[model samples]
Target chain A: MNNYWSAIVNNLDPYVPGEQTKLSNVIKLNTNENPYGPSYKVLDAIKNSCNNQLRLYPDPESISLRDQIASLYNLNIDNIFVGNGSDEVLAQSFLAFFQKEKPIIFPDITYSFYKTYCQLFNIAYKTIPLDEYFNIKISDYLPKIHKNYIGGIIFPNPNAPTGINLELTDVEKIISSNKNIVVVIDEAYVDFGSTSAVSLINKYDNLLIVQTFSKSRSLAGLRIGFAIGNKNLINGLIRVKNSFNSYPVDKLASIGAIAAFQDIDYFNFTCNSIIKLRNNLINDMINLGFEVLPSKANFIFAKHNKYDAKIIYEKLKDNNILVRHFNKDRINQYLRISIGIEEHLSQLIYILNKIVNN
Target chain B: MNNYWSAIVNNLDPYVPGEQTKLSNVIKLNTNENPYGPSYKVLDAIKNSCNNQLRLYPDPESISLRDQIASLYNLNIDNIFVGNGSDEVLAQSFLAFFQKEKPIIFPDITYSFYKTYCQLFNIAYKTIPLDEYFNIKISDYLPKIHKNYIGGIIFPNPNAPTGINLELTDVEKIISSNKNIVVVIDEAYVDFGSTSAVSLINKYDNLLIVQTFSKSRSLAGLRIGFAIGNKNLINGLIRVKNSFNSYPVDKLASIGAIAAFQDIDYFNFTCNSIIKLRNNLINDMINLGFEVLPSKANFIFAKHNKYDAKIIYEKLKDNNILVRHFNKDRINQYLRISIGIEEHLSQLIYILNKIVNN
Candidate 1:
């Protein structure tokens, strides 16, 4: 550590994102990216926006894009807030609503970035353990479980690594239970099949639903994400945002995200296809002696009955296949694989069989 | 204000950026945007990078873009860091280095965002008043002025609103005086004509130089900016960035920025023409009885001695021309005008001439 480093920096254990290896011809399933390319409409809109208008700044409010999101959710413009990515929205949320006199609560096996954000913002936090089957138990979040105060709550709806989705009813239970604190539902993987918490945003004033174009919208490289919440929660997020970075969303990203929402037909078709592929992949893994979690997102978390998970991950990597293996507690034996197209899945299965047999 | 708002949000006076008015015919001069569009190569690069790769996440490391910047400055890759925009870099810098036991110091009439950042981060600050002619006196930063405490220092080169450049020697003096404190030179407008303190980074571990592609490369809409400094300082910034947002810059932005640097001849031509136009605009303002500052940036700060600044601003707005007029102490009577192209300038002069004659 450098002597000049701040106490915050020194204390931060920065989040390690999924590997973005640039290897060509690799069947990359590690990052949970959509197997398909962005819609033709998204590509066309971004291409059209690459003009001289780029000389000026974008609308800091991202009005048109917010309008598109609002209309999609049947919410008003005041309910939406946009940013560089959902990660940024989460970061700002930690700064805006999570830092208080009390500790916040999140799932121990949820998105790892939540803990990283707590460290960065100096927010005290307690991680409630997920169930043995890797599902988020809403009862664990009830205030009666702990006498200590809670400033806020946040977690991915269809949680990462485990890819297990909490039912919307259960989600509402947590929000209602946390009557005095904000409950952030990170629906980054919601579009895959899980029900959105967005519909409940109007009922729960403290509920904030964070989503991304990175996942279902197929715009990770464009870096756009947004929040849907009541006006006050959105305002708090926006206030932290304005103080951090005025123009978080760029011009091309704005147009591309707006177009992504506009082509509702394309979005639905893509999500349906991914869900179909996920089910097929799960069937194949189960037949191959793996126990896969009941996944509602675009990925599957599984462990083979015989083979070591890390060894299998390495063997697949040697054959030019990439899947994520977490070396963390309670889940080190599990492998999280993203659902690619049919051909990619066939190739993955073909390789996995060879590695297991060998 | 919302009752759910955090204490930080409640205390913050969010920065008001110059408007991105949707009106087409308005000759906008408020925000200091480049008069010309980015080099044609930027468009081609972004368009080419806009395809299927968008499905995957961008490089959180932003390696190639940092490489391009390092090569440009003839520094090692460790000396550089890239972010969404200089604004984000500045925000991270505030978190990384500036919050300390002592209150940081900046010019009273500098970029207004500095104070907003201070409030957002809860960092105490002391603003040294600019002299009668709106120039920062280097000696004012001497330890003798604030004997007991000083955290850090930052100000725009060719200082904002005044468009006055500080000599490199004076910049060195400030860094030298604050031996242990980080000195941030926000050289956002440096590409026009002012000397950048980037070269002095090797000598001072406490120095962090921030630059943006918005002004010179005409990429405000693209939102790309970078910082150069010692490896330790860069490491602190990186730790903060990774904790906050894994990837701030996107694929299109990375390629667009890299291509902008590759076409140096085009960049030089654009900057020279703007500098030439700024000289012409200064001459015109003086002849029209406006007291203009000696500008080293792509903008001028001037006031017509005969007319109230607010009235002139309102009159220009009536003519569908927009310029920034800050209603603050010492500089309320001035209009900070961005230098547009010859055609835009001609339109501006025609309108201003009419306003003055009337």
Candidate 2:
């Protein structure tokens, strides 16, 4: 440990995102990024933005991008807030709503970043155990059970490393349980599989929905994410964001994200293609003696009882295919694989055939 | 106030950056951005990076960009860290170094964001008053005044709003005084005027130097910034950054920053031109009955004794020009104007002649 680090720094267990390899020709199915490039309109907008105006700072409020998102969601711009990415938005949300007198609650098997954010903000947290099927139990999250030690709750829908989703009715149940306390629903994977909580925002003032352009919009490189909530919740996020960095989204990012939202046809085509491919991939994996979870996300969580997950991960890496394998006790046997293009999935099957069928 | 806001969010006084208008023809001069576009190489690199790989996550460590910066300063890659912008880097430094039991010190009139950061981090700070001549009195920072309440120190070189700079020897004096605590020297404007204390990073473990590409490199649209310091300090920042967001620098930002550094000749040419234009503008302002600071930066802080600064700001806005006028005391009478191209400045002078010389 470094002697100069603050107590907060010493306490932080930094979040480790899935590996992003620099090698060319590797079939990437680790991080759940869309396998397709953004729309031509997005590329054109970004290229057009590369001018002398590159010298000027981007809009701190992200007014244009926020307005575009709000219009798409049938909400007011006051109900929206944009940031560098959903990770940045998620981090800001932890600072804004989750750091409270009582310990916050989240799913133990959800996005690992929740724990990291709690450490960085010095907020106490309790992780309610995910059910045996890797599902969230809404009843277990009631404030009465914790006797007022409940500050708030946050969990990603179509949860990472599990690829299971909570229905809108169940999500609303949790929000309704914590009326006074805030409830954040991270929708990073929502576009691929489920209905957004945007409709629930107007009804529940305590509901905050965080989404990203990184997955479905395929603009991860541009780094844009946003939050949709009531005006007061939006204002709290704005305060935390402005205090952190005024211009988190650069000029090109703002323009590029706005263009992504406008290209509805292209976005729909790519997302649907991933869903079809995901279904086919799951069938193929099950045929190969692996048990795959029912997934609505662009990824699947699968395990084969006969094969060691670590060994398969290593063999795949050696063969130029990368997938995520968590080493934790409960998840060590499972592999979280992102859905790639048709060609990428075919290549992955070919590699698995050589390794597993043997 | 919002009831859901955290104690920190409730306590925040968020920073307000300069206006970013969507108009096509305004002579923008409020934010201190470079008037020139980035080199052709930077543009080509960004275009080349706009491929299907945009779906993949950017390298969280920002290895290539950090390597280039480290080599420029003759330091190890471990000694460097990069972020979305210098604002992000500066914000992280506050969380990394200045959040301690002792109070930090900065000039009362330095970059306004320092105070905002303090409020957000809940760090106690004491602002040392700048002398009547609008200069940083380095000796006033002597540790003898406050026994151990000094957590660290930070101020912009060629200090903001006033555009006055401190010599290298004087900067060393402050660093020497705060030997035990981390001292951050923001060099956001150093490329335009003063020497960077980067070289002193090796001699003193407590010194951290922060710089940004937003100004001199003319890549504000890309949002790239960095810090060079002792390995431990850089490590501390990495922990805080990773805990917050894994990939602060996006893919295009990484590639564009590397291209900007490689085109040394183009970077030098633009910086020199801006310096020359700043000199000419200062002379012109003095001729027009305005008292201007002796500036080594790309901006000049000036006041016309006969005119109100706020009125001038409003008049310029009506005339489709924008310059910054802080409504705070002691500096409310002055205007901070970014040095635009010769055409922009000439047009500004023409408008001022109509308004002031009338």
Candidate 3:
């Protein structure tokens, strides 16, 4: 509210990230982080990079790391754009391709940051509501559904909070219909079970797929994320990035993420473990009379038949367990629980059974 | 050139940072990186942080690192704002404070990124030409100098490339006269030899001081920087940062920076060594019949009286050495050479002597 602030600052509705509590021994299943640590190889690589060469600036282009990501996706380095994190990459995308004379569109109940970005960039937006079953309807995004123009479209595959993944076919339909505009597929949780939209990149020049090392790769602390898109689309992001921060990815982060991409066995093992744990947790919640969404992410969205969602969330917190409960419309009774280790989930289910019965 | 890019992207002339060549055995002094590495303690802290905890997201507010920086300046945590690098901080500052009714003003030949930011944010600006001696004249920044409106002011102290430090009293005079507008003093190279405007934070709420770990603290590869200012201005930056990237500083970066701030003795020793080396290098350049600016930074800006600046730059590159040369209108003749180790400088002088004589 300072007078010195720009008018945009006063209007900015900043994004509130999930709680990152530092309390020790808490079952922290709130942020959907991977239960397992990143590959031990990543640690070794980071440790090896901690040398005198740190006196110099990291590569502004992050060429080697981009090359690694390119190899994984069978894309060229020019198709990739890396940043401090996926959040930063998203911000750049909004400025790069979304702002226009017409408003952009997304799921009404998708990642809240999309709306926040709209406010920050003064881009007009309309949120099309999800279907009654909490699924993204490709029909809702058809151009004929709206009379006014649409500048772009963006939604997370295997969406957050609900964790329901839209099939790859629907993703392509949206991209094809929005050929005149940029269609961003935010695949932050894609590695758990959902298919990637990256395969369609060559077919649709306007398709941009953004992913992160935070979820399946388990490198949230290193803060690495990237976008895979057409070379021209990537160049647009690069222009905005070069205008902003020349070196968004630091040396250690680049090295750590490169190692994460290199260890295919470890990556597959960890993602499979999370998917297995997620299924087990879903089954346990269903047995306790909770109705759960069909989740493709590492987290589950569920509501109890008897107990109040907020009360259950509090009880879990009181018992030194943490899960996310969004106090928002149409989803107030649902709790988003991230999958933890087998032992932690066992304790969670045991505690939930007592809370629900009582 | 893409139609999808935001209208601002087309007008943006992005800043071209010095080349980060991958060539080996080159005496790299192009960027003002410290000749020495970060303290051993910093490396140890970073290595220790490479563990399982990296599975979780870093603290979005970066409380611990902010505390360390606040303690260094005898200020509160509310007065400090940390970001990916000084460049990011500078970019945030442009969006947060400078996009006002009137055009902001800076030196025509200052850090070129300032102009790039003005273009990126679509903020109007006027660049006051430096005096014939290449020093930032405080009078030109005085409110009376321009009949039209002035939005704000930002300039690098020990101004970039030229490396001439403006007196603290002059900095205060500009800040005082421009009380209606925010004044930013970028002190990226302040630790080398110049006094910090941090001493003046309490005196003026509109004064914001930006500093970085790249040059003096020897952590360019780590990408840590901070801004010290009034609580309200800091709040403004927080709003913009939260809207953009909630956690610009990653986990390992935060821990590594805290360690760098803790080892004050190492910081001072490295800074003093660079200052001593800079003085010797200046004297050597003067002996070689080159005119050098009165530098107060880790880099020296010099031009030979007879030799063409671009040829010298290329010759040095050919000799397995790298230095910066801007081909802009005013400073085209100057070669900005970073202060490297004694051996690197001796070789520089020997080669320059031969290049000039031969």
Candidate 4:
């Protein structure tokens, strides 16, 4: 630490993203990135955008892209707010809605970035423990039970590392209960199978649904994420964003995401493939004496009955395969595995069988 | 104006960027975008990066891109911090260094975003009035005079909207005088004709130099910007960035920027062409009875002696030509005109001649 650093810097324990390996042969699954490439149309649109127009700044409002997202969601353009990624959107959301006298609430084991954002913004927060089954318990969020005042609430639907999706009714119940505070539903993994909270947006003025192009649309490298919310909420995010970086979403990323949305067939084909692969992988793991969570995401969470999770992770790594093993409380034995293409999953199962049988 | 918005949002006066129009026939000169396209190599690099790897997340650390920048600046890779744009870099800089009990100081008429950032971050600030000629007055910043507690110092080199370069010795004086707080030298317009304070980074550990690809390399649409500073300051920025957004730089932008640095001849060609255009534009404006500032930037700031600035701005717009006019204190009479191609400038001059003669 230097004398030049602000006091906030001393308190910031920054979020560490999952390993991004440069090694080509590794069966990378840590970050839950899509295994399939984005649509050909996305590639074409990005290429076409790489010309003279790049000299100019991208539209600060991201009008066309937001318009496309609005049309897709059957909402107005003002209902959409885009950013460099969902992480940035979440950061802005924390600042826009959660900075109050009372603490915000989220699942303790949800996306780890929430805590980091709280520290960075000096926003007070309290984490509610997930149910023993690793599910977000909606009853815990009710004012009658929670007791203490909350400024806001946010959690990933189909929570990370434990791909269990919170049911739509429960999501609505939490929103309906927290009528005063904003309820942010992080839907990063919602498209795989789970229903979206986006449909509830019109009914709930305080509901904000955050989504990304990274997992389901397969454009993680492009860095595009957006929020669908009430126009006022979108305006609040826009205020924070404009105050920070006017054009967080770059031109090619915006163009590519628009193209990804245009191709429903391609999006469906890829999401379906990951789901099919995830189901087969789950059954194969169950047969090998592993208990996998009921996953609605592109990835699965499982712990082998006989073998230690870290040891299995190491063994997979030794065989040029990689999966995430969070060395945290209560879930240290669980492993998060992203669904790769068919052959990659087959190879993963073959290796896991050897490790578990031994 | 929503109840859900954080209290800071109510206090925030967001920065309004210069108008970006979609009119085909308009000679756009409002936002100071580079008149020329990026190097062919940069475009080629972005196109080559448009394939399957987009399914994966970009390098969260931006190691390769940082390495390229470090080599170019002759600094260690640890000294470099890349962001979405210079605006984002400035925002992170505010959070990393300038949040203090003491109010930061800057020129009253500078890049308006600095004040907007101060407001957004809840940092107190006092603006030192620029000298009568709109040049940054170094004496006012010295602790010996105009003394109040100061947390930091930041202003664009060849200060924005004025395009008046601060002498290297004067910049050194300010850095040396303010040794305790972080001194940010925004070199967004440094490549045009001014000397950068980058040479003084090793001498002054508190100095952080911010630069961007928008003005010089002409890739504003890609949104790449970076800072060069001591390792400790860079680490502080990294901590904040890691907390906010892991991968602000997309894969294609990183690759494209690397290619931008590779083609030095192209970079020099474009900068020199703009400089040459700027000189000619200045001469024409002066010949037309406008008092042009001694510009060392890609844009020129001038005002017609006989006409009102807003009227001239409106007349230019009537002719499908656009230039920036700030409706603020002290600088309301001036027009900040971005230098365009030879033909665009010639048309501008022809239209101005008509307006002045009429």
Where in model 3 is the C-alpha error above 4 Å? none
Write the residue-wise lDDT of candidate 2 on B83-171 in tens digits.
Answer: 98998999999998888888899998979999998998888899999999899987778777767568888888989989899999999
The lowest-lDDT stretch of 10 consecutive residues in candidate 2 chain A is A141-150
Docking tier of model 4: it is high
Q: At residue A175, give the lDDT of candidate 1.
A: 88
Every candidate's CA RMSD = 1.1, 1.4, 1.0, 0.9
Task: Report how far off residue B275 is in candidate 1 (Å).
Answer: 0.8
- Which digits, one per residue and each the tens of the lDDT, describe model 4 over residues A239-343? 999899989999899999999999999999999989999999999999999999999999999998878999999999999998999989989999999999999
Residue A336 in candidate 4, Cα distance off native in Å: 0.7
Query: Candidate 1: DockQ?
Result: 0.83
Give the CA lDDT, 0 to 100, for residue B324 in model 3. 97
Question: Clashing residue pairs, candidate 4?
Answer: none
Better of 1 and 2 by lDDT: 1
- Write out the backbone clash pairs for model 2: B103-B149
| TM-score, structure 1 vs. true | 0.99
lDDT of 1 by residue, B1-358 (tens): 6656667888898888998899999999999999899999999999988898898899999999999999988999999999999999999999898877789999999899999889988888999999988899877888877674888889999899899999999999888888778889999999899999988989999899999989999999999999999999999999999998999999999999999999999899999999999999999888888999999999999999798999999999998899999999899999999999899998889888988877
Q: What tens digits encode model 3's per-residue C-alpha lDDT throughout B1-358?
A: 7887878887789988888988878999999999999999999999999998999999999999999999989999999999999999999999999989999999988898998898888899999999999988888888678653898999999999899999999999999998889999999999988989999999899999999988888999989899999999999999999999888999998999999999999999999999999999999999998999999999999999998899999999999999999999988999999999999999999999899988
lDDT per residue as tens, model 4, B1-358? 7889999998899999888788889999999999999999999988988999999999999999999999987889999999999999999999999999999999999999998899888999999999999988889988887474899999999899999999999999999998888899999999999999888878889999999999999999999999999999999999999999999999999999999999999999999999999999999999999999999999999999999999999999999999999999999999999999999999999999999988
| Predicted candidate 1, C-alpha RMSD | 1.1
